[model samples]
Target: MDLTGYPTDFVADLGFPGAARRFLERRARHWPRLFLNGVPLDDTALGGWQLPEEPDTSESSILGFARDAAMEQHWEDEGYALDDTGEGPFALFYSRYGRPLRAGAITGVAGVPEQVAESVESIGLMLSGFFVVSLLTPDDPATDPFSESVLRDLRESFAE
Candidate 1:
């Protein structure tokens, strides 16, 4: 579907641009497949191949409405918020922002997991498939372009 990843600047500002890049690295030394239940992510626009199911949301929020559905309907089965809970949807979102569900360079979150989680939910609710958050969607192919490009940019910026 030609999904658009996050801008390079967004990842860099989070402080783990390199890790995020490596997380998305396509190099042989690096793993590209973001698998879950041993199955490749065929539904992904970025061709995730597969990523292990994270403790957080499973489907990449950047993929589209269906992915977002999976996130809210399935991933947060334990709980994000509740009309009953009354903590507000923001409570769950706070737990997910920028936190890596799966540990790695690219998947590594630049912000706090809770914050990223909350943001993901908020983004999903407000922005839907168009959500453009790196922390909320580190595995999203749309999170950063070519992982390598983002990493190179980060390295250059860091060096300077």
Candidate 2:
């Protein structure tokens, strides 16, 4: 995979090859759900992202639209529920976690629906599950786990 088009800031903050390896390790320990532009990597139409209740601290936040009971209710009311496991279309692109992170949205990457043969596929793997990148917005955000602080925490947690 070619990572030539991924965001420079993300690459700089979290070392690429190391970060990618770490992400794979993290995925092995838990479910695969990476954040990019505040939203998890999903092709579903009604996509939403989560944010921290307290932005000042480094602790993970549980605030999210889809995580809301109402949203779940709405989906249930419509007789639909979000899948709770496994990789979807881009499983091969994803690492051992068996999931694909959404690096397709970032600039320089190929557009969605386009065929990608050997792309390095960049994505923000939100390790905390409830945290998101503090730097970019949904409109112009990097992949999830974009938070350097949270990444440091993840490294420590994994080290233990």
| Highest lDDT against the true fold, candidate | 1
Model 2, range 1-160, lDDT digits (tens) per residue?
Answer: 2211111122222122243344434433343344322344443421332221233334422212222334334333432222232111111111112122333333454423444412424543332122232211111113433233334433443333
Q: Which is the leading candidate under TM-score?
A: 2
- Model 1 residue 84 lDDT score: 28
TM-score of every model versus the real structure: 0.18, 0.20
Flag regions of model 2 displaced more than 4 Å: 1-9, 32-160
Summarize candidate 1's per-residue lDDT along 1-160 as a digit string, tens digits.
2322233323223333333333333321222333332233333533443322233332333211112233334334523222222211111011113342221223333344777755554231221111113322222224334433434433444343
